[model samples]
Target: MSATIVRRSAIMTAAVAASALFLASCSSGGSSDPSDSATGSDSASAPTGVTLVMWHQSADADPQLNLYKAYEAASGNTIELVDLPADTYTTAVQTKWATGDRPDILEYVPTPQDMRQLNMSENMLDLSDLAFVGNRVNDAGELDGAVYGAVLGPLSSFGMFYNKDVLDAAGVDVPTSYGDLMTSCDAVTASGADMVNIGGGSEFPVNMFAGFAYMADYNEGDQWGQGVADGSIKVNDPEGPIVASLTTMKDLVDAGCVNSDAATATFQDSIAAVYDGSSALTILPSDFISLFYEAGGGDTATVDETIGFGPISAEKGIGSYSASPIGSYFVPSTGDATKEAAAKDFIDWITTEGYQDYVDEAQAVPTLTNATTPDLGGLYASLADVLMDPSTTPAFNQSVPGFGSFGQVSVSVLVGQASPQEAADTWQAYVDQAIEAQQ
Candidate 1:
């Protein structure tokens, strides 16, 4: 953020006048400063007059839309965007793909299990050789060690959100651990605010609570994830964290720390409760920081002083890490070499010289070592700090082989249809089925 320089990486590009595309080849160490210019044959250049058809979720707006325009202006290319509803984007992509419909590029989830619907190895380009892949990302857009999607944005961190005034008025410090959390519930109730809010009606938030506790207990959950991936770590284990987490949920409810309408409340309702000072906290991803402030109808400048986000765990200040929040660009195989190379050029441009432009515009945390990080104040700054957590574990879905939801079962616990142990058993059944299908 301190320096302003145009980014120009060494991407060797030759104009294909007839096809109206540039075949750009990039070296790993190309300069990101565009002002430095393309100096060598190994350097890459922005494509000229290439028109790319791209698809993005409808929820994607603002700086995202502007970022694409910036790329078109800087690279002399036209990107025709197709917006699909976020809830149905993946299903629509798959349905269309079944009929041989494919876009030149797509904004999609980068995980292997979630993205497998597209048949990536056979249909998508392997982006391992892209200049930024070696450093800027770990598993954001990777599958089997190769990068498929270009993740040129901030990684989403998982944790709890609290109203600063709510907690302070209750005369309680931020709870360090779940055990620490329990002790403060009485004071929070005395202050006349619900201790926490949940949207079990949506199912995801209920599972999020369980997952938060699981991640804290096993930081860097690679070994446990591997167990789940291979079907050895059964979700039904009587002593598993799933059972414990649900038991904790019941205890909190019995203690009057949670809202009466928890099972019927939606995620939006929970955020509204915290914003209206009806509740003290809600467990959710940091990406939703804007919604809480928006829900309150308060000025944006007061977000930092009014709201705070932190890790919710068995241990204090250590939380879960989920890469799913980091949406990435995936280029499908078009069988046109010229257009294909142009796609790479576009990806190269955004993560390099054009990245700072977006960081300034979107106020995003820079994912790359080379890119300067601006002061991301408010809850965002706290979320950014979570990325630096050395012992953070991957989100539960990280190792799962396909689209599976722990929430699908955990919701039963909230409704009292199943006990914690029973819910775990049902989830384990689903996990076993998914792992077998993989083989």
Candidate 2:
């Protein structure tokens, strides 16, 4: 579902490319100028058939699309949805922004890393003081204590999802840290299975390799970005999370603690490796439960029975909430006073008055205090447990601007091409570069 989770563009060229794509897409959808700058009130006017341009990817669920229709019917406001192509959505958005074009409302990944690209602090309407803020299950879109994105449904957190039966058979308690994980490799290998399956080939989950360690910090890494930004923290610190985590990865490789085909393994392979009992565990997001569903013939019963979820950390069981903001919506600082107010009203109404209906429409596990969690399954329950954990905090990628690149070199740790220190050094270079660019 993710891919733009990072990608930079050739500013001028992408802007040119975006012009044709934007026009073509807008012609078929509803056309609106994103550069509207008639600033006025921050409050919504009574419904008068105002059309709000909403930019979303094709992956926007039918429930959400239908919800928009329901919203229009109730409020008499027209939501002109623009379905941008998922692959180029971020770059296209960036390009549109480069040319001073923006949507009234936009759906995005809602990560500090991603938000940094959008300059959310300067560009997005703050949702911190909204009435429903207290009801939110997690702070998915908060940066520097300011909330900017509202995640209405769906949740994800990353960790080492293990096969309970396999780990139990291996006589391994859920290891508290990567070092603790290594102490059980002998027991795990003796049980005739690999220790963990790093899905290196997909390259998507690689970030979690080192991120788990950073996220498990004392403050759950909420201040990680601030540290890096203010030059108080260094990515390449020899004793830091990056080197320590990556070194453990290399040690796992040497200790025969990973799958034989770990280098080429995909997410599917990692799922099967653990679920089919070929490996004890895999490092992935809570959504691995969804993939395991496919492996088990779409059976939630099988998924719940065989799989187990636990938070991963460097030296403790502490974890971070890493949910993808699927139903999250961001209102741009579009400067059209009327549209801005309507956008705020939409957020307020959906999260308050229309919330129950919204939850029912998505069949989502309740992430609000007012709603009750439905009977999705044991797997869904586990996913929600980690997502709503009181101790967990937003991940580094969720707090640090441009922090996505910090973990970009983690796959090299998996393939043994870079030593832990080397990986950390590379990350430090990226951090320095990002800080310079931001400054």
Candidate 3:
């Protein structure tokens, strides 16, 4: 897939609330009860055949469509696939849901409040009984002990992926600390290359900086989420590490470390810049290594020998790299038992060991603990140590409040529109606002 499509898919998973609101009428009522609600239970009275209408963003449509076909062929059920452009996915889902036209199975990104706000917790089938989904739903995707969604893909880590050739050509070792990373920018630039290529126009890339910084500084497992929940941690707190990270980014810009055009570059363009040798490294998702191979014309053998992956910084004792589960699938609470059963069955089949193998073969990673990592060609084969390191954690972008806006603020820092300090402060304010709004 193109970088733009990848980014859009990630955004769709993260910002389900924003898009849901625009696409459908908000339902205000008590949250649906998974134990006793009509939307929650399976029908015992009759054998009813159901057509499960499913919706997913374009980036996911291809794989999911194939999976659904497998599901139908195996189970003898009809599944209607609705593939919408990633840009329009949220709007379309909301519109369909608002008009009282609901899909039996829906795949979208979810925030904590989405279930209650959209009444999906009440309207979609609850999959708590399914072994695969029942195992993965934490507080992040659940509310009040009920799960509304199932994580569908492999967990992903976010960090700097370097073109080994570029780094080697510049005589710079892969950085092990933030200080080294900042210092190496000049050496990279001196070699007629930019140090990093980030797509600031997209929110997720910017959010990654905050997530990485938080992981770097905080040791408490899930402390970032706790801070947001308790109003103790703010995204922009001048006293916090995220601000320092932002400042460092600003310092790089001042030093001409990143591409001058980075602030406005689309994700695809930025990836292209790295591929064509205009830049040395880029902050990328774990799947990027595989994407890199594809972009180089699917010559895995040729690509495997050249790429490397590492944590977001070289700052030892600070933090390890982290990843979050993005673009998961969820079954909404619906009033029909037959439909609910079918939904759960479909989810179970997809996340099963057999299907996970297919996913690993197709997508390079499987989210389930039972699945094996696919052969990621050569560019990423070298970074296996970094990607699977026990020390790595999930990035806060998937969990932190108000982190979605980090990209815009980072862009401002890069373009001199906002001082790093101001950007940090703004982020904290956003966190505070989000906490209050959620409460």
Candidate 4:
């Protein structure tokens, strides 16, 4: 077998960690009174033979998809899976809701705007008290003290990923502070290689800003979205912490430490650059490490041994890193009791014992500490440690509502289309629009 196929097969086997056992029922079929109003027990009153229309974007090979089929077969309930296109899925879902043809369950990125767009607070079944909520590592979709969403994949963090062999060859010690990082970048470049493989073609520049801002938040001990909530600060202050954070990325650009083809390189391309030893470092979320391994044709051991993960920092030197939610599933309160109960049952089942299998199959970080970790090894394992830290805070984009504009504005600054101040002003407008949308 080809090495790539071997690795792909390994990934698939890992994701299918264990065969899933169909739960007792997808419906609340017991004789319990139907209108009990208790969250967990509602399943007992769900009717059998009810078809749940699940609208989602999970891949055909996703382990959860198989589990969906298992639940259907075991409980005699039906799951009408409507797979949607990724780029237009959210808009399509909104259309369905507007036209009164929404699905019972929804799959989305779980961003604040996405949640609000679905009328989450008003329409989703609250999973706050589910057994799995207690095992969660972070508070993501919790709003007004209610858990409205469940993750379909593992939680992950964004930070700096470095190639130890490359850095060592350049005699650059792992950077401890933002200034040290700049110095290291210069040294790595001077060694005749790219210092950081920042793929600027898409929203990576936004990720760059976010990485620095996350470090700043850790250094200053201020939560990223707290200012918006308490009215103490605005995200768009030209001189604010967020915009100020971009100065580091801009300096890197000026210093020629960023890959010259960054403007056109995709994130996977950058990962490949690092894997090929053409670059010493890159900024990305921990989840993308799988691609780094894949680019090496499944040479998991060499990839893990050569690369290292560390938190990017300001003066505080690794005060914290940011945790972002991934694979969020929501049970929209479709106002149909049977469907709602079935949705709850399905969500609840996935998050239970079957969750580990899902995590294994997906090769994602388990939100529950008790779940087994996939054998990703090396930098991924190291980054996973940081993600498990109690001091970890939510990423700025995840914490702040309507924060997609931050990425767009950051892109303009990276490309020299806007000054930092101009970008901040533009970001402020987005923030204002976001707030207005919430209202």
Which candidate achieves the best TM-score against the true structure?
Answer: 1
Tens-place lDDT per residue, model 2, 1-439, is 1211211112112223433444564566632222221122224554447899988866565557776876676677889988775434566677777898888888787766677788888999998878777876555666667888887766556677788888899998876578777888999899998888877766665666667533566333456656777789887889776677777778888889888787777777888888898888887766455567768886878777888777778776766655454577889998898888788777776666556555544545544544433434466666555554555555666545455555458877777788888888887787777778877
Per-candidate TM equals 0.82, 0.73, 0.77, 0.77
Query: Each candidate's lDDT (Cα)?
Result: 0.68, 0.68, 0.59, 0.63
Candidate 2 accuracy as lDDT? 0.68
In candidate 1, what residue range of length 10 has the lowest lDDT sum?
Answer: 3-12
Better of 2 and 3 by TM-score: 3
Report the candidate with higher TM-score, 2 versus 4: 4
The predicted structure with the larger lDDT, 2 or 3, is 2
Compared with the true structure, the alpha-carbon lDDT of candidate 3 equals 0.59
lDDT of 1 by residue, 305-414 (tens): 77788887865557776554234789899997777877877787777667765654455555554455554667766776665555455666666653355776767777
Q: Single out the weakest 10-residue window by summed lDDT for candidate 4.
A: 17-26
How much does candidate 3 score in TM-score? 0.77
lDDT of each residue in 1-439, candidate 3, tens digit only: 5322333343333323322332332253322222221121132432235688777766553455666676676566677777765434455666787888767778776545344445655676656677775334123345556666776554455666677888899999987566876778888899899987767664445555544533544533455655665776666677667777777777777778878886777666666777777888777666455567666786666555565666755366232333222346777666677776787777776666335434544543333443444444454433444434434443454446665556667777877898888987887777677667767
Model 4, 1-439: lDDT tens per residue? 5322332233233323311111111133322232221222224664568799888753333455765765665456788988875324556677878887778877765645466666777788899867778766545566666888886555555667778888998998977566776788767887787987877775653555344424435422334465664446677666666666677667777888778887677676777787777988777766566667666677878887887777665564442433233356788887788778777777776676356556656655555543555544576557655554434444555446656566667777677788777777787777777777677
TM accuracy, model 4: 0.77
Error of 2 at 419 (Å): 1.4
Please identify model 1 stretches exceeding 4 Å from their true place: 1-51, 84-101, 219-221, 296-298, 336-339
